[model samples]
Target: VNIDYLKKHADELKRVAASVLTGTVTASLLINKLQSYPRQNNLMYVLQSYGQLVKTIFICKYLLQLPLRHRINTQLNKGEQLHNLRVYLWFGGDGIIRKKQEKQQQVTARCLNLLTNIVMVWNTVYIQEILKQLQKEGYQVDEKDLEHISPAPFEHINRLGKYDFNDEIRLQENGLRALRPPVDKR
Candidate 1:
């Protein structure tokens, strides 16, 4: 609860956090290498360790982001680590063999892979839902609306042929016209 105490500990906390981040990144890279081949039980332990490293780094970063004098939420912190560990153990570990025993085998290489897939799926669903809500609010996507958008003047100039600046101007003007809506709409 003491502001001075928190400030005094900040440097130590930052150093610990940096080391955790370094470990997490390093482990993540190694896991990526392992994932290129078939899953094995031995690899699971490595991935679990990597997952723990990632969880540790994430927690440290989360705590560091919080305001000084604010106590970290113990339950939330534990929940995040447990969730990550579960995902590591269940989806990223020897789950492949277990799934085979159940007559269904699906493979995931590492905790990072599982986490990435989850995030991607969630992001896709979230974007679709947001688009639906936007449409419901009367927002519409129009291809023709984007016609007025053009490269910056400098960009256009840079794209010109080595010895043909005039030709570039003509090309740009023609491109703009092509982007416009057709005049003879039925």
Candidate 2:
């Protein structure tokens, strides 16, 4: 985090950023070319300093803003939940990417993503149905409460056994499983 270096090379940094944004020059290619040289790269050093400054500013804002912190934490939790869901779904090969080839690995990852999306969609559909039922029963359903609800929970899902999709009805008309009746907690 050399402030002096950043200040001295501010114009150059701006120029480089503009060039990258305009597609006039590629950052990775420039970095690769720079690394090929034996000498120190001042532009690279400046970029590193700029990156540190931006990160420091973000940290400051994160510490200062309560709403920002809450939003960030919620997003982070969602990401963690998604990762947990992926780990659960990737039970095969002990959750390891066994495929050595890049294409095979890509296919495995894409398939996992597809499964995760399907689970989310399924959970979301059921959750919405349950909410609708509760509303129909004269229960107070809040928008704020809906905002907090996540489709990441997969405790009820049977991911261990093989699924027979051939006989399964598509989620078009009465295709989703029946929603369990909501118990009165009061």
| TM-score to true structure, per model | 0.20, 0.73
Q: List the residue pairs that clash in candidate 2.
A: none
- lDDT (Cα, 0-100) at 82 in candidate 1: 44
Which digits, one per residue and each the tens of the lDDT, describe model 1 over residues 65-84? 76421334544454564455
Tens-place lDDT per residue, model 2, 1-186, is: 778888888899889889889998898987887689788678777877898999999999999999999888887888888889988888889888999999999999999999999999988888988888889989999986775678988787787678777866545466776666657999
Model 2, CA-based lDDT: 0.85
Question: Candidate 1: misplaced stretches above 4 Å?
Answer: 1-109, 143-186
Name the Cα RMSD for model 2: 3.7
Q: How many residue pairs clash in each candidate?
A: 0, 0
**How displaced is residue 161 in candidate 2, in Å?**
5.5
Q: By TM-score, how accurate is candidate 2?
A: 0.73
